[model samples]
Target: MHDDLIPFNKPFFVGKELFNIAQAVLNGTIAGDGEFTRRCQAWLEQHLGTPKALLTHSCTAALEMSAILAGVGPGDEVIMPSFTFVSTANAFVLRGATPVFVDIRPDTLNIDERQVAEAITAKTKAIVAVHYAGQPCAMNALREIARNHGLMLIEDAAQAILSGDRGSSLGTLGDLGCLSFHETKNVISGEGGALLINNPELIERAEIIWQKGTNRKAFMRGETSKYTWVDIGSSFLPSELTAAFLYAQLEHAKRINSHRRTLYLKYFELLAPLAEQGHIKLPALAQDKPANAHLFYILCRDANERQALIAHLDSAGISAVFHYVPLHDSPAGFRYARAHGKLQVTTEIANTLLRLPMFSEMTTAEIRRVCGEIDVFFKITSKQPCELS
Candidate 1:
């Protein structure tokens, strides 16, 4: 059983990922701001309808850039869900701002919008809403709150590309949006990300901060013969080699997305029975919202049950795993979160949730094999299954 250890997530690159890298090598422009970088940036802006898109080293970089763009600093507070990666909160925390961790929706695993208004106060400078598991967050409510309170909206769309509402994209719904192209993501370039600017006001500053506090972007446009340092910034850009690989993925975006969606639906359909039997809670899609099915996760009854399910899968040669340890529980966050509000759902769901094998190139047989193990676990445990399909 241990012979074939199906990983929880794997990067699937069938496009010109290697070909483009070779191209970048031949071009001798493997640094940032190369042709591939510009191409990927343009592709994101055009498809996602963003005014400007800046490619960064990772989603963390993009979020840090957002922190700079948002003017987050000491004494400021950023509201966000505790059920997320550290970068979601650390971006603002790095700027000396406090992260006002909130509870998540029990169903969707996204930030609970209702709790947000209650948490907003005089120090709340921004709201970082993460579209958890590629599902759109309560953007309408969050946007309204930001609008009425004059706060900035920064969307962590790392798991959500091409996942949005009726017409508007997920990242575009906020002032600034961050995306990841980590190997585990639906799209991969080994390690890369992008910062999408929705509000036009931040475009100039965004470029400045991205280029490490220089006016080099303007100089590139022939606007200035000499560019100099002007603001606080860092080298958040990635190499052109990375961008080149990303461009190849973007070229076959349609096909890659289609393959991932196929595998996603297969898992959903195959695991429907287990959901109905109350063994696990399936990931929920937002009403009328389109998601990339970027991940396939389920919530077991408890920590013990989740552990048992994972063990059972492991014994059967399937590799399933858990995601995000609640920041409130982690040592680093414990100090700052000591005085924060209670994280009731965050702590609970953090233990119960389990992520299954999900990748673009996964076969139907793989889904069935994984689901078979899940079904066996539920039957053996005799726990109430979640009513989901």
Candidate 2:
């Protein structure tokens, strides 16, 4: 038909998504915490070896639940990087806690663990480590800071479902971890997430919060004869329909991760020449951290270079876009979050970072084509045009 327009992301579906949904519907339990929901939660718990896992409508819901469990409130401060998804800070802000924005490590674009320690104050209640681009941050350093300050550590692992740090699961290292199954994430459920409870003490309370602040989960387990509202919470559980769709994806999560990893390494291999020539910077990963190959991005020399490259890709019918508008610079951030350091790294990456097309269904030829466009853009910009199609 027409030149195939590559999209930034394409949601993948395994064979069982439909069948599982039909099965869930036929089972007559469309509500949440049904068979499929339990299955997904069990899968997460078993895979991550966490004490407990509770499904939610979205990663945002999971973060909010964690914030409630952390006892975050007015006058409390949570340290997090400004380069992350807003939910990382919004979750705590919803409970009246202030978000202290810090700079990110220039190498991995992760929250600078060193800066986190300096930001902690008497008002600090927690530290939220956002694993940028599915690469786990220095969880060990962040953990030490949290323990020293008596603050809770939360992993906003929305992009790092199966990643690890130093042989340990990425999300499982923190006191609380949150995962996303959004359309763009490695796993797809349209809209779903889970709260990963590593701290055994919070297991019972976390379950209660997932069940609309009631002891319904306890009742389901026969722990209580009757359930009622016992704490302040919300309905965060995902419906069986969402869980069924997610369960299908979870069944093939390893395969999906493998497919994406293949694409990721290929991108690096194809673009390494440019990086060597100092034309662009590829993703940097620490030796101890293993990525889940969630998204592939590059850093241009400057914001203008990034814009021109995006334009060239657009003309080639390829989707290339920038990411994150430095939450510290956003309007809501100004109102609810306070900047701890200069946030220079966050500001720079926010301007020059360009995310390339990534998906399980994308082919190697499509990836090569995208790389070709990037090479063309740089050559033409440097006034040394190279012809290739």
The residue-by-residue lDDT of candidate 2 on 173-262, one tens digit each, is 999999999999999999999999999999989988888889998898898998899988898989999999999999999999988888
lDDT of each: 0.87, 0.89
Clashing pairs in 2: none
Among all windows of ten consecutive residues in candidate 2, which has the lowest summed lDDT?
380-389
Q: In angstroms, give how far residue 273 of model 1 lies from its true place.
A: 1.7
Candidate 1, residue 301: how far the Cα is off, in Å:
0.5
Off by over 4 Å in 1: 288-290, 338-340, 383-389
Model 1 scores worst on lDDT over the 10 consecutive residues at 380-389
Q: In model 2, which runs have C-alpha deviations exceeding 4 angstroms? A: 288-290, 383-389
As a TM-score, model 1 comes out at 0.96
